[model samples]
Target: MTIGVALIVGDTLRRRWHTDSPGTRGQEFPLLAAREQAARSTAADSTLASQLTLPEKPSIAVLPFQNMSGDPEQDYFADGIVEEITTALSRFPSLFVIARNSSFTYKGKSVDIKQVGRELGVRYVLEGGIRKAANQVRVTAQLIDAATGVHIWADRFEGELADIFRLQDDMSQRAVGAITPMVEHAEIERMKRKPTHRFDAYDFYLKGLASLNLQGSKDAADEALQMFYRAIDLDSGFASAYGNAAFCFVRRLVNAWMEDPKKEIVEAERLATRAVQYGSDDPVALTSGGFTLARLLGELEIGEQHLHRALELSPSYALAWTHRAWIRVFQGRPDEALPDLNRAMRLNPRDPLMPGYFSVMGMAHFVAGRYEEAASWCEKAIQVQPKFLPPLRTAAASYALAGNLQAAQTMMSSLMQLDPRRRISTLRELYPLQRNRDWELLTEGLRRAGLPD
Candidate 1:
């Protein structure tokens, strides 16, 4: 056997080294040519591998669920479940979720979790099976730590098939809600062991996000801006970095922290423009850029178009929905804004930006002439973030309009302590409400709450 194997290897080497055609002689050895071609292929593969390194944030891939209903027709239903789950997971900006097209390549295959992890460059994999019988459907999903092949979470969902869409939504929501927290916990543990010096542009971006999550802190916003700028310096084409930097200016404007208004507004516009130019498909970039354009630069029409495109790209992106609601409020369409705000809250029930959501809800109600409801929402926002300026101003105005003079006075006192320079005359300049009536209403309530002209 050894001798035969040696003869075969010798013959193979001879064929590879010799050119089959005499005309091709002295041009190149076949084996050397093959090796050169392989070298080029290997270089390309290495580049691809570098591009596929595990993302800085928690990343997950959802494989198509098996259709175990004994009917090939049920395949579509199983695929729908995976699609819904993928869309829901994509709503989370902190997660690096793989799209359905890439994940569906593993459909109907018995895959190795570790292989999926290596190929997809993801930390977690979600796989499951669906069974349908009569008017009912059952889904069994398990989330696995791709590197370790350990099951992190598993759940079974059973629902009526009469409303398949609702079932899909419910299942996806439940799965995502459970999976997100697990992934976050795993990421926290992973970060504890990761060396700080291994930082990349994405690491800087994540650090910026961490600072931004400390809502309503001027110091935190400043730190976040620095981190984002560092990320942009490292990766000049980073759309989200530019978008977030623009949003820091928006935060400054909202909180009256801008020391040089004209210069800051110009910088904000420049950053937002670059974000829109480079991030046509990135919902985070679109949301921040569009909001800044509308709210700060007064480019309402273009801003609304960008925001609409963002929603089309990511229907469940909570931040996009929230900003769209804010734009509606600015457009004097409070009735329309309320629904979008509600949708945003539903999509991200535990969002760190809940204070902003509540404040926007209050603004919508206040603009719609529901003073009591507005005050109620503003109070909720204040309770969550006691120093949040927008809610403080809105609460003061809403309370005064709702005939609660004492509460209005108390809120006005807090607002004054936060921004002693606040004056009724500056309200329109700061807010820039599109409708004269809305501006008049806001100023009147502030005046009644004892703000000076």
Candidate 2:
């Protein structure tokens, strides 16, 4: 029972940044460009061009909470609070949350709002500080209009150290509560939010989440898995960590990065089962666990039930919708999956994982017998992640099915370069698609593209 430092709050601050040059550090981000275009199209008004283009959904960035405890060891606690807040905010489909990695780039630095807003492409920013004294903590936070430097909301929360998790949940929900009223007073949607109760386990989970966001290389994923495993060891009841650990195993298997697929699959199934069993009330845990069960273990019915419950618990959770869409396609119901996929895209238009979303959309289209549209979507996915084998394979199959043999052959060659051992013979074992028709469609396209059957 080691509680290093509880969260402490300081003061409220607000500022705005403006454009100076074409190549300003944060002004020319590609991520922002895409978001701006999406926002403009959604607005459907040329008159609004003079104003700052905001996303269809209110967008925000939660900067790293400052550690005012003076003891640097409490740094982890401060970061953990910010991560939890970010996660809670992301659960809302009507809110566009800048990922933790992008927002954390400003950690410990004096940032201009113009630069931050431009770089992150967020309309609002939340900043805060924490000060801990023994068993009690004080937390102060404020929300700002990035374009106007106006302080829309601010608050202070103080609680005993034993209620650290509750404090974090309150802080996040309160911030969302404040922002929604300020921005969307006409339609303020509320949700039943849940939090992990254990502080020690949560600390490790936060660290693991940060590592998972890296996704830059295999080393990063492995490190994330290690951190998640440590969290599970510290608290075997930490279901979210188990769910994430199972996902890491799925990633390895899909990318052909696993040295022993049989062993990893067994471990993944065990973790997924445990995650669902223990995390019956946790939406994130249910989403990830259900996805792993259906996608990797072929347990479609149980997986769909968990996912359905997750959505019922947190209807605005975009990831759960995305996973449900994925399961639907494998269930030979691609038409039914399209709405969920589109809903996911609208919820987080600037998601860093848009490549995967695009690839899934392509799969939905492919299964609906729309080969050309499928090829187009898969191309976008491959553009975002060239070496992403799933999208690569999807692109090849779509192209071949569309009668573009040359393009299909080119895509297959690229896929083979990434995974030299890939073959149609193992598609069933790898994808675990439940519907026979869906499996046949996938295999037939790949075979037409020259994949060894």
Candidate 3:
């Protein structure tokens, strides 16, 4: 089975790149436009940090770097650098790093450092700028103590385009060391490891990340998959790209967007396996690949092991925690899932994928027979993403189980309008709930809510 799946994925990848080159796609669909749309959406929904409490460990937010290159097109480069720095810092279990989505909300704005700290619930803020002229680049960064408005550390790095990756590593190390001097030298060395030797592949991966951050939209997900595939074509060892490509399929499964479910599942599983194999030390790859395995392929134990490895690698990775929480829910351990969900929410309160966290929370509650609470969380998820199917299905089932026939029917009506083909009989295939009782509960609730057999 594994060899057959590998051959299928290998053929599909070859055909895809043979017909489509990265150059033409970039011209047809500008990455900048996609990034701008995502930025606007992120800024609009950036309200998760209202009077937040400080974490127990040292916390910091890396704000969007200013583009000093005198070209608006350089915004992506600057933003990508900040995101890389943020990700590198997040690997440390002792540092509480604000997610890129939350920190980038302050882009192109002149803000007081103290206010940024208060809004992000961090003790420190790292702000920087990038200037690229000819084949050379200059970068400057300052670490500020947000509470006292004091500059703790500041530095500048200058290097050629070829040395850009080294410059980024230096900046990440400097920022991490300045914020938490207690971080081990080994951890700093781990942050210095480059994702890819090819700059083009890294660029494509960054573009893919921008598209993935948009979430919810099928078009965005497709674009992200294409970008990741392009990256993989340039650098086959790029595990993060492979992992994210698999996650695009996971999104399709959740939203009922797969045209050929069986084929897509095989492809997703293949991509996920490659991600895990190549990215044994990468948290993003492990988290995405593990979640895809659990949700799409029903490899619950293997997926949980991958997720556990991801958390062990980067305890601050909110998505890993969220994925692990869902895995617990699928394993019929709702009690074990809730705390992980809460921890994820606290780590990255402004994550764009909060609706997903909410939906999984609803599932956990539903599995635990807390019908009213499940309905509430699923309703919140629906409000954020009205067309999302899982939350809508769970909301209907929860309301029906709670004996609110009118609410249950209303939710079912909305769900059916979104995906008319969905039936109670398909629940098992659609959801990988482990326990027989949980399956029966969902089927009964859906039946009560007027779903067809």
Candidate 4:
């Protein structure tokens, strides 16, 4: 197929650069425009962050598929379809998609189209509803104006459950075809809007939520709490945000930055349950709910199930994978957990939390007695975040396992400086393994690393 290059003109969508030489559809988008478009679009998105560096390519968020079937049980079927679509869309390496963590933040939210564009920093948004009965499924999807609250294109997909994958491909193709443009108007589509939505205070709350998820330090956590309060003042129905608020508190506890773990865990559970009640199928709510049940309530099986369901609904979801990976690592099958963490990294390579992913990968290898590989991965992790706990510990442990006591001691000293009291005991308590094998593997590593009993 012969393709020509054409530069898209401002205000009107057209070929950006016209050339006698053929260019792929992706190449047709001017590099500068694509970058600007992503920035403009994210500034429009209402997710948990501001202008994000995208994955391989720009990405759009597909929120939870609405359960239009009026049958509660069929909610699973709808969620499954969205999960499939999210997975398919992510396979393309060109778009930077908001991890489900940020995307699902809008689960119960009524948003301004421009705000969606601004917040997610994407050129488009794809959302739809599913109505299913017995074997019949009807799905409707639309690519919308994240800035103008306008629908650029819409399509309805109807078929039997057996043809689910086909429907997903069709939806992705339509969305990709409609939104993949190089240029249009000076504003593209993201316009600075004066939001006049239902909850004025909630707007600030959204801003705060975005800030907290930036995942840096205590300052971010404090900001998240403040935003949750603001959101509650505007709409108490914002139960989902409340769960997010509790999540911040739980982070404090788990990181040993808190005065009381038990008390904070209780509060986290309360908020998580409320979020679930308010919006059941929401991936965010499910994450919070699952953590509370498993980590706080010690309901291991149910917690695993909830976390599993969350991943099933949003395959490109990094946070869910993070939690799930930890669960597997603790269960003694670091081998099983490796893929989950790898998936998280691929979904958001620019994520500042790269250290965590590397750390876990190293630990998984270390526990499996792959000392050389563990040390290698930990070194890569330290390049990202020097003070990152898991990778630091893994480095020391890997060295010791390889019988390099001097090197192990050196790394241990650094780890101790970063965390004054290196507490293997605390890690066990916070992330108590549901499986005996996971517990044994990790603990055995701690012992090998010269962890004091």
* Best model per TM-score: 3
Number of the candidate with higher lDDT, 1 or 3: 3
Steric clash count of candidate 1? 0
lDDT by residue for model 3 (367-408), tens: 999999999989877776677789889999999999999999
Evaluate model 2: give its TM-score: 0.75
Relative to the true structure, how large is the alpha-carbon lDDT of every model? 0.70, 0.71, 0.81, 0.59
Task: State TM-scores per candidate.
Answer: 0.59, 0.75, 0.89, 0.57
Whole-model lDDT, candidate 2?
Answer: 0.71
In model 2, what lDDT does residue 5 have?
A: 17
In candidate 4, what are the lDDT values of residues 1-453, reduced to their tens digit? 111323222211122211223221111111223343344234223223455444445567776667898876454456545654664454333444556444554555676656655655665688889997777778998888665678888889999765655666678767655655542232211111111123344344455455465554554565555556455556655654665665776666545455445555665666666666764545555666676666656666666676787665445567777777766765567888888876665454334355566677887787677988998888776665565566777788788778887777777787778666556676655555666664565556556666655
Can you write out model 1's per-residue Cα lDDT over 334-374, one digit (the tens) per residue? 99998888666544433334567778989999999999999
lDDT of 2 by residue, 156-213 (tens): 8899866776676677667677667553532223333443566666767776665566
Candidate 3's TM-score reads 0.89
Rate residue 135 of model 4 by lDDT. Answer: 72
* After superposition, candidate 4 runs with Cα above 4 Å error: 1-198, 292-298, 437-441, 447-450
Which runs of model 1 end up more than 4 angstroms from their true locations?
A: 1-199
How close is each model in CA RMSD to the real structure?
Answer: 23.4, 11.4, 4.0, 19.1
What lDDT score is found at residue 243 in candidate 2?
A: 89
Clash pairs, candidate 1, are none
Better TM-score candidate (1, 4): 1
